[model samples]
Every structure is written in structure tokens, then in C-alpha cells.
Target: MSASPWLVGPFVDMLVGSGLAYLMTLPLLLIISVRTGFVGWPVLLVTLISILVSVPHYGATLLRVYEERSQRQRYALFAYYLTGILALVFLAGIYSIPIGSALLTLYVSWSPWHIGGQNYGVALTILRRRGVEVTPLVKRLLYVSFVLSFLLALLSIHVENSNHVPASGLQAARIYRVIPVGIPSALVSVVFPVVLMIYVGSVVGAFVGLVRRGVRGWPLVSVVSLVAAQALWFVVPALLFFWSGTDAEGLLPFAAIWISAAHSAQYLWITTHYARRIDPGIRTGTYLGKALLAGAFVTIFPGLLFLPDWLGAPSWAAGLGTLLFAVVNIHHFALDGAIWKLRDGHVARALLRDDPGLAAGKAEASVGLGRWGWRVVWIGGSIALAVTVHEQFERTVTLSGITLRSLDRARDAIARLEWTGRDSDSDHLVLANSYLQAGNPDAAEKEYRESLARRPSAEAVSGLAAVRIQRRDWSGALENYDRAQRLDPDNVDLMIRRSDLLNQLESETPPVDRAAIRDLQRRSIRLLERALDLDRRRVPTIVRLARVYTRSGRRRDAAALIQAALEGLEGLASTERAMLEREKRALSDPRSGSAAGTRAGPVRPGASGARP
Candidate 1:
């Protein structure tokens, strides 16, 4: 009951966070006709994969229906879940992946809230299994978590709304990915084992009914152990030194390798144990174990790629973990659970024995080299994971330009903070600034897509329109600009950019409608006029109108506008003034021509015959 508050709080918060992410795509939702359409593909894929891999447990048992030759029927969800997870695992194993991995990673590695959500689901399942009613505390905490997640989502949305983002540099996203890799190799190896113990301990506690037994007794003792162990991973492990000890920073790789191997062995061992006596009678136990193991390797690993490095994490440890799980599942849990049903409780009796109850009969077990073989497999898997990591970061694309680094830095920063207490709008604003600075149109565009996914904000639409402008995607720019204008009609920059795009498009249309051309010209003038109205000292507004006049065929008006803008540049340096003078001359000269030799064209129908 005491732990209930912590569990429910994060769980509810995660669900609420997910819901906010879901709702934030409201614009995209409107377009797609599904409220959660934007995030659905990845989430559904992960769920499907998780569910699929879980079935082999069932298959293993069903095989014993005693007829290896008989046709077999398997549920579809099992396959789907397995597929999703395996897909992710394959992604982690490679140096690079196909486009699908990129999209899938976003859903799988979205935030800690997602991981917390999964944990909550597991916790709730536990509550149901024991037929325990959630006390008022659990309910209250759940509501709190919901509020927290909602608030975070709101914060994320707010961050995404800002425009002062970096347009080029180390995208913050990529930076997040790199940090964990460098997590002082000394501590790397100890993390998984420590974490694993806690997870397993929690599972055991559940079985022992410590959770049901309330706080302060034998259960509390176990809970205390679990909490202390878990804290060491996140906090500086001052006490674990007695056991895990210290290592030189350079020795981290070997440690990581060892750690990975240990987990792999553990998971596999547990899985096999679970499968062995997992009677053909029931459907869940063994299959669920296998499915979850596969999910660990596939979905979890692959999903990390989408995570910014900070939260991204390495998978060799998880891979090692999967193996470790197999051992515990089969030998420790499954075999034990099955033994529970025996009339005399044979399985429990065997587990209690140090001599290996129901030991593999001497000849059948062939003890020769068996233990060593497992040791080898465990070590090998860890080595493989390390190798995979070595390959993933073999090259760096930054250090070449400030723009790239700035963008990368910002992306990592935003991704790291996305789940804490922010909404999509705020997250997008942060992501947008990074993307904009990075000169990465795709990243910027993604923020826009994210914006459209949730609630449509004037800022988000405008940011998207600006991204469109950078990409030279005039049509999209125009569309987003229009939406932004409707949301914030009096915004000066939006009007100017929108008018500029329209004018540019009008020029490109061959045999364009004279009425439309005239309308655009008038619109351009009005927008410039509006900008000046918003801020009378705006020189850029003056220059922009001059360009409009030139485009519209009024050379005299264009010249006068240029002179006006120049008058405000008295404080500019000599070189700057000279630059401005040359620009003014170029605009005023009829033959000052654009594109090397071509003369400026007439702006509209029936104007001075300079359409050439």
C-alpha cells in the first residue's frame, strides 16, 4: 500500500503524458481522421512486436501435444509483438538501419514516460492477479501522475512554440545519444547487473506477497534491498564498492562485455527454465516470458537509436539481460511454478534443494562441459553487443561546422527533457529552434509534423511555414503561412514572409492572370505597409516594399523606397554603407540586370514594356 503511491503516480503520469502527445497531433489528427494517428504507427508496431515474440513459449509446449507432425495453431498477437521487438533488435545490431527503424524508434524510445507506462501496466497486472483492490492511496497517486504527465505535455508544447531556436549546429538529439556511450567506462559494466537484481528482486517480492503483506515486516526487508540496489545505479554507489568494486576507466569495454554476457546468459537461462515444465494446460506463463525476452532484444534495442544518446542507452547489457532472464525463467521461475501444481509440490521441493532436485539424470544430463558451454555463450553475446556499439559510433559528422554542432546540441537537449514536464508545443519549439539552427529541414519539418499532431498553435504553423521557406517549398510555406495568419493576423513577419512567397509564386506562373497579379501586388504593398505600421522604425520593411515596387514595374517608386531605407543606416559602418549604396544602385538601375545579363522584368500586365 505504501509503494502504491509511487507506482500509481508515475503510471498515471505516463498514460497522461502519452495522451497529451496523442492530443497534440490534433492538426494531423484532423488531417488523418484519427486522434492518435501520428503516434499510432510506432506504438502499434511496438505492441504487436511485444505480443508476437511471447508466443514461442506457447509453441514450445504445444509441440508436445505429442504429435510433432500435427498442424499447429498460434494466436496472431504473439507473432505481431515478436515481429516488432525483433525488428528493433535487428536495428540495434547494425551500424545503420532502413527507414522503418527511424520511424519505429520514435515510438519505442519516445521518453521515460513510455518506460514508466510499461512498468505501470505490469504493476496493475500484478494487482489484478492477486485480486487486490487499489486503495485510496493508489487511486490518488494515479490521478497525480496523470496531472503531472499532462503538465509535462503542456510544457513540451510550450517549448515547441518558440522561434529563437538554433538553425545550425550539433543537433541536441544526437548529442544525447553520444553521452551514455562515454559514461565513464568504469561504471558501465555494473549497471545492468545492479539493475537486473532489482528487477528480479521486485518480481520475487511480488511472489512472496511482500507487496500484499504491507510495509515493515519481512516484505519491507526485501523492498529495502531492492530500493537500495536500484538507487546505486542512479546515485553514486558508495556502498556497492564492497561487492562490485572499482575499475579503471579504460577497462570499461571489457566490463561492458562481461556485463552484457551475464545478462544474456541470465535471460536465456530463465526463459528455458520457464518453458520446460510450463504445462500444456495454460497459455500464458512460458509464452509471456519468451515474448517479453524477445521484446527486450528487438524493440528495446532498436528503439534506443531513436532516443537521444543521453537516454538512448546501450543494448548489449539488455541482450545480456535477456540471456540472464532465460535462465531464471526456466530454472528459477517456470520449472518452480509447474512443480507447484504437483500433488506433493515436487517443483517447490526441488527448488529448495542445493543438490539440484530432479537433477538431470547423470547420463541424460551429460554434465561434461555443460556449465562451461553456457559461460562461453554468455561471454560471446556480450562481446557481440560491444562490437555492435563500436560500429554504431564509428564516425562523427560534427566538428565540421558550427551550425551542425549547435543543432545537434539543441536536439539532444530537447529530447532529454521531452518527458519531464512539457507538452508538444513547448517541445516542438525547442526542437524547432535546434532544427532551424542545424539547417536540417527534416528535423524542423518533424517538429511541424509534431505540432500538427497535437493542438495547432499559430507559432507552430508559423515555424512550419518558415521551415518550408528554408526548403524552398513555396506551396507548403504558403499553406502554413495562411494558417498562421488566421491564428495571428497582425503578426508582421508572418505577413511579410507570406506576401514574399506569393509574389515569388506569381512571378513563376507563365501567362499568369493579370487580376491575380494585381491582387498580389496590392497585397504585397499592404503587408509591407502593415509591417511598418507595427514598427515605424523598421528599415527592412522599407527595403522590402522597394523590392515589391521593382517587381511590380514601378522603378521610380522602388528608387524612392530604397532611398528611404538608406537614410536610416547612418549608424552603419562605412563598408556597410557602401554595400547598401551598391544594392540601391542595382535595384534602381533598369539595366542593372539579374542573373548576370538579363534585365529586370515588368511587374504586371500592360506595364512599361520591360517584361523582358
Candidate 2:
């Protein structure tokens, strides 16, 4: 029971344990570089990681389950039956958006909890391997910390007012349409900090308890590193949202990519250790080769089934890849749960001990498959890998072109993809955004319609509304915005945009059309008020609501709101602060009448009016 054995080695263990910091921070740094006019090429970074790390990690679980006869028999229900069931579900999703979106939602919603479980299991394994007494009470503290951290991360992701669009090419493959399980922003504002504090307290309390029990050395360092990694993965981001009002939507996509990558690497690290110990003779290279082949097949081969012509589905039936991706991940989560139980005798012996007899039950022979069968698998998987790499490279080029505002490069890559019949709703939406950026409203409108025809999304609908705004089709723009709001009911930005549009219509109405003006003013007031209710501290909403109040002859309410906004102007951007000042001055002038009321012109369509 000496604490002498390390899972891999002390260095590797510690590095993987603390790797989340590097994984998550790298995306943020890349984003900063992009913002500062440097080419970060994040799409390329994500593609490489998926091929090298993420996909293979899923393969590691399959290898663990089916590599040996005993494991296959022990987990037959999961390995054989459940996988078949999920495959059918995947196919169903290919033809039905609601079904596909729900499946995608389940995968995303489960991801944080799955990651938390891994971190919790790893921490306990580290402690037990080092001979630290993991009493029931100690386990409870660690469990609570991890659970709260997961909750914090989950809440930040699905908040009602947050943007739900896929923000990166990595996410674009899986997130067809997020079925948000929204926590209200008001509730998040109140709950996030309280839970974060308790989470921190639990971590500190667990560490102090472990130390009092004489847990020291690499075990202590490793466990502490895992805790710190979780904080970096979850807590710090929540803090940024709750404290500084940074939008979680802007950060969650990158967070999801990095956290998944880091988690996968950790999974591989432990599984490789277990595999080596269990076989005692299998080279790491051989095992990884089999794992990568299995991973590539699982991740990519199914996508071929979803090809536009494969099942005679229409070309717009493009998100079957997303469904397949979700199903694969769900399958991976299931197998991992069943096979990696520490309470199971075989699992414990393999992971916690270095006894020579650990390999006594080694069964490396191919199960039910002959040499040629494996060769077929290897050949098919390699082909799929090549195809996926090429596809992903093109995607990288398209996204990078869009990011850098090289519209021709993006258009060329997109056309090539479409020619290959690889068109997707997200790709169309992205191209539409690029078209809008290039000021080709006609092309933007066409792309947006194409996207909607493929799969109706709030983003696509919003893009169409932006095109309408650019055309000065105020009624049409309002209609599309209303439609977008229906799709994304709790979107604060959409609410503000609708209110702004209403105010614009009101100002342009003939003064003699008092009824029409009144109607517009009332609707604008309601939308702005709703936005304020969703996020009371949103200064722009307050300012807009105040202007509506003034126009509608609620001078006292308008003055009160302007004063409140002015009090908080110090934290706003300089341009925003100056705009608010001007509004306040106009509202205060005695000679100012309807002319001084907020008369927002058609803003650049698709541009957000304020931070949510």
C-alpha cells in the first residue's frame, strides 16, 4: 500500500492533471490575437486537436470495452445493444430537425456532468493510490465541489439571454440547434456567486482535511492540481460573467472545445496506463493504433451514411453529421460509465495496483474478428480519416477566410464544399454573415434564405431580418425579428433590436397618425421593459426604455431611468457613455419635443446594439 506507483509517471500525471489551464487559455489567447488583427486560425487548431486528440479519446473507450472478451461479455448490453439503439436514433435525427436538435441537446447537456465525473474519479483514484484515506465524509466534500462546479458551468452555458449560435467550426459540426434549458439571467446573477463561493470552500475544506490525515507529496500536488484545473475550467469563467458582465455566450464555445480536448487527453492518459498494466506486454504504439482506427471509424464512417445522396435524402439534409456526432459521444459516455467503475473489482485492481499478476487475465486475441476483418476495419477507417481530414481542412480555410474578411477565399471554399454536396446550414449562415459584412445585402439575403430552407435557425432568421433592415423594409424587418424572437424567446438582444425597430417606426410615423404612433410607442415600451426585466443592469435597455417613456409622455419615469443609467455610465464603453450623455442632455432641454425623443435610424443590420 505504499504510494510509490504513479499512473503514468509523476511528470505526466501532474501535467495532465493541470492541463486544463493550458487547454482553455489557449483559445482565449487566440481570440485576443484575432481581435488585435492577428490571424489566430482557430479553425485549424480545433481541426488538428480533433484528429489527434478528441476523436481518438472516444476510440479509447471502445477499445477498452471490446478489446478483450471478458469486458465485452461483462458490458454486452452497452457494447452491443445500446449502440445499435443509438445508431437508429442517429438515423432518425438525420431526417428530423427536432429529433436531431433534442439529441444534440442531450449530448451537450450531459457533457459537463460527464467531465465532472471524470475529474472526481481521477481525484479519488489519485488519493487512494497514494494511500490517503478517502472516508465517506471526504468523498462527500469532493463530490459536492465537483457537482457545484458542473452546475455553475452548465448554468452559464444555457442562460436564457445568452447567444445560442454555434461560435466555432468545431462546434458547428455538433450544435445544429441548441435546445436551451435556460436558467434566467436574473437567477444566474443571484445564484452563480453564491454557488462559486461554496464550491471554493468545499475544495479548501477537502484539502485541509486531507492534509490533516497526512496526505502529502505527489498525491497532494496531483489532487490540488485537479481541483485548480476544474476552477480554471468552470469557476473563473462564471466569475467573469457574474462580476464583470462579460457575455458567457462569447466564451462558452471555446471553453467547450478546450475542456473537451483536455478531458479527452486525461481519459487517454489513464486508459493507456490501465491498458499497459492489464496486458503488461502490449506496446503503447500498438494499442493507440487500434484505438485511433476504431476512433476514426466511429467518428467519421457514420457521416458517410448521412451524405445527401446516401439515403436519397435531399441536399439540405446536411446536419446528419451533427446527429451522428452526438450519438457517438452519447455512446462513448455510456461505455465509459459502465466500464470504468472504481467499485468494480477488476477496475480497482488494474488502476490502483502494480502487482505482477495484474496481467494474469490478459486476453489480447481479436474477439470474433479474424485478421482480414480487422484489415478491412483498418482500411475503411484510414480512408474515412483521409476524407474527414480533407473536409476539415477546407472548413478551416473557409472559417479562416471569413475571420480575416477574405470573402473571395471563403466563397471559393464554400463553393467547393457545396460542389462536393457537403453544404450545411451553418455554413450557409456563415457565408451569409460574410456577405453582409461585404455589404452585399442581396447576396446576404439569398444566403440567409438558403440557410432557412436548409434548417430554420434563430441566427438565420435574424440574418434575414438584418437584410430587411438594410432594405428599409421596416415592416418586413420587424416581422422577421418577431419570428426570430419566437424561435429564441428569451434573447435580450433580440428584444432590444425589436424595441429599437419599433421606436424607429414610431418616429417616422406622421404626427397626425396618433393611434399608429401610440401603438408603436406602447410595443417598444413593452419590449424594452421585458429586456430590462431579463437583465436589470443592462444600461442600454434602461436608456432605450427611458426614451420610449419620454416620447410616450412619461417624463418623470424617463428622467428617473436616465438618471439611473447615468449613475452606472462609468463602467460603460466610452462611446456608449457619450451617447447616453447626449440622450440625457436632449431629454433635459425644455425646447426639445418629439424631435429630441430617441430616433434610432436603421443600424447596420445584424450588429448587436449593446452587450447583453
Candidate 3:
């Protein structure tokens, strides 16, 4: 007798698994991080992320089993996609090593966006398709939760991991931050590709014994390919994102679990997709209850604790190794539950009976191809038309990737206006860069003053300040930094730069005051330290602290601190390592951090961590 399917199976699994890990690591991580001011934001944040991930784990595996037994290639295709995804994610784990561990943590950290953008969408889509119609009110609730969870996730990521975001401008690595394009933090990350190789080499490779050689699956293959398009592009990869970790040694077992759970979605979906044919509402909620509970217990509790540890691990092993091991154990449990349920006539048969398309239309192709052929042609054509229109519109606005757009035209016009006539200080400051680049320093000078006259913006003020720095107008640069600081207290760079200028003027002065030099250095160090506390991974702060230490005759201390900071960077990729190396060199060089770099004049503005 086959065990009946339980809709709550996954949830049960997650609760159980998480409960176990929770009992194990909670006392350790919590005790280490416990303090009055500490918000357990990471815990709530991670739990939220894990639930989104757990739901799909069993969903994917269930889908695979149903597809294989029922000749449902669509579900099989979806399951295969889970394979491709894990392959890519594990590959990235390889790449993050050597650069530094802290730098690479961003690639493996959990994000709320994946839950909203991928998990929620897939889960509801599966449920609705499986005949579990959501009420309008329920739908609204899910939508709101989805958005809120995502926003909160993003905030938590920012609050907890500030180093990944740049100071205030566009950075290529940050801009191209997804997997394959950047690191392996998301579902489509390169890590999955590595895991895929292992699976094929082992699981599917061994499952070759299960293949029926004489079977011809030509139509079935096409069906698989079609449904697979959705699973590959969005559904499975969403699950894959959760599997991304710091490195391969820690990623292997978790990748296995991720693949197993993600495949269950396909199993469940296949049962739903054909429930109209094979069975009707067949113990779906019950079997779902078991699979879901099984998955949830395995996924939820202890895993959340590891998220922070991984995000803050000294080594990749500390962060990801334990998490991966836990994931594998859950995967084994899920695989067993699914097989047992299937053999015992649980949820799968009930679902097949309920879905009209599966039993009533058995002669029809597995993926609804016969009826869906025309629909495909129409949808394909519509997509082509829309794409063509978009291309044409974009082409009209661009020439060699540079748009003859409003911003560019405005810049060009500003240049000609400055060149053709004299401008006020405020206006000149706004257009000084254009004039400078155009070989019109006189015009730039005139505009710089005019721009300053017209209620100086930080951008405009910084512009004039740079011009002063260029021309050795120390007084003017100090004046600009003071004004900018007034406008934006968080201008960390401006504070440091101002300190530098005060030092420069002292050397040119007749009786340079030693007292003033000490004062400026003290002020600069204070500002730098504040900024570092707000964001520990701040490169400028790191460099500035080293310089201050070197100047104060703490040479060995400076070196040790540098090593500690670099330790945070071990798992980073080569590009990231290079960036850190550059910063390290700039800090360590005596010439750059020389006493001359610390001569004093007027004091600079201090640093504050308050939001601008």
C-alpha cells in the first residue's frame, strides 16, 4: 500500500531539520553575538529566506518522481534544469577563493530579492496550476508579503553587509552583481554548473540502469524541452540561489540537497499538471502536508544561524561547511519520503485523477503540445513583434552605445555656453569639467566662481574644490571642504582630504606649528575610525587607519592590522584581490603615508555616521 501524499510534507521536513540544527548551533552563535543593542535581525531575516527556499525543495523532487513514472517529460525537463543550475553555482565558489573571504561573502549571502522575484512567484504559480485556487484576499496577502519580505531582505543585506555596496557611485562589479556576470550569490550563479557535473557523474550516471534503452522519447523530448524553458530560466535557478556558499568544499552536500528539494517542485507540479487525468484531489493536502513538513523541519531552524556565520566567517569553511552538511542530510530524508509516498499510492495518484488533462486526454502529447501548438506559435510571434519594436526604439536613441540623449546634449550645450560667454561662479562650477576637458581653463575658472555663488551643491562645491587642489589653492580647497561638510556630514573623503590640505599648508608656512600638525592628525584619525565602525570593510578607512598608525610610530601595529583586514578578503576572486592589494600597497608605502602628508593648517570637519 502506497503512502498518501501530504501537502504539508515539506513544511514538516523544514521544521524538523531546522529544529535539530537550531538546538545544535543556536547556543554557540547566539552567545558569541549576544549583547543589549544587538537586534536578531539576521535570525528573522534568515528564517524568512529559508522558508522561501524550503517550499520549493520538496516541490522540485516530487515533480521529478511523478514525471519519471508517469511519462511526464515536462516535469522531467524541469528537474533537469535544477541540475544545470547547481552546476553554475558551485563553479563560482571556486572563483571566490584567494581574493579574500570577506569580499566573497557577498556572493554567497542570502538576499530577499530571490525570495520575492523567484520563490513566491513559482510557489503560487504551482499551487494555482495544481487546482489550489487562492482567494482574492489570500492572493493580495501573498503579494504584499512577497514585496515586503523582499524590501526587508534588501535592507537587512545593506545593514549587515555594507562593504558590498560602493561609497556612492557606480561600480562595474556591483552593477553586474548577479551570477555568471559577477559572483555566485544568486540562483543562476556559476556554482550550480560545478554541482551538475558531480550529479551527472554520480546520481544520473548511476541511474543509467533505470533507462529503458528501447524507449523512443522523441515527442516526449520536445515536451520536456518546452516546459523546461520555464523551469530552467526561473523556477529551478531560484532554488539554486539558496545553495550558493563560500567554496566547493562547503558547497557540495548542500548543492545536492538543493537539487533534491528543487526537483520535488517538478514532481508536485507534474502531479498537478496531469491530476485531471490520473486522479482527483488525491490526498494532495495530506501528502503535501508530509513532504512539506519533512522539508521545512530539515530546512528552517539551524540553517538560519549559519547565514550570519557564513556572512561573517573568518574562513569559508566556518561559514559554509556546516550548512552544506546539514542540507545533505535533509536531502536524503526527502528522497526517502518521496519514494515511500510514491510506492504507497499517496499524493501522485490523487492528483493525476483530479487533473482532466492527464487521464481524460492520455492520447494527447505529454506537455499539451497537440492543443498548445497554435498557442505557442501565436505567443512566439507576439514576443517577436514586441522585441522588434523595442530594438527599433532603442536603435533610434543610440549611436555606438552613446545616446544623443538629453543628458549628453545638455552637457554639450553647457560646454558651448561657457566657451561662448563668461559665467557666474555657480554656473561655472557646474560646467567647469566640460570647460577643463575642452581646453578652456579660463572659462572653467570663471564658471567655478559663478557656480559657488549660486547656492553650492556638494557636487558643485566638490568640483571647485578639485580645481583648487589642481592649482594648489590650499585655502580655496579647505573652504570648499568645510562648506561641503556642512551640507553633508557623512562626506568621509572630504574630511580626509581637508586634513591632508591643512598638513600641506604647514610645510609652506614660515613657523609650522607642531601642535597644529598633531591636532590635524588626531582629527583625521577620529573621522576615519568613525567611518570604519559604520562600515568595517571601508577601504578608505582601512587605508587611513594604517597611515595614522604608521605616522604615530606604530609600524608593527599597522602591519598587523593590515593583515587582519586582508584576512577578511581571502575568499574574494582575483579581481577583488587586486583591488584589495592596490589599497594595501597605497596604505603600506611610507612615501604615501609620510609626515609630509600630515603637515597642518586649519582643522578639518569630523565624520558622523548619521544618514545624509
Please tell me which predicted candidate would have the highest lDDT against the true structure.
2
Clashes of 3: 128
Q: Summarize candidate 1's per-residue lDDT along 1-612 as a digit string, tens digits.
A: 222322223443222211222223333434553433332223223323323433233223322221112211122232234335544554453333232233222322232232233223333433432334555554344334433332222222122221111111111121011111123334534543454454445445443453553534322332333223222211222123223443211212222222222222222332343334333233445444434433333322333333322443322222222322222222222222232221233322222111232334212221332556434433543443343333222212221123545666645544443332122344555566556655666787787676555445677777777676676676777788788889888887777676667666666655446677767777878878888878755555565676666666776787776676578645666665565566587875667531112222222211010011
- Each candidate's clash count: 115, 0, 128
Candidate 2 lDDT tens digits, 11-92: 7777775463555466676677557754333666776888788878888898788777778888999988998898787777
Model 1 bad stretches (over 4 Å) = 1-424, 436-443, 451-456, 511-513, 565-580, 587-612
**Which is the better candidate, 1 or 3, if ranked by lDDT?**
3
Top TM-score prediction, candidate number = 2
Better TM-score candidate (1, 2): 2
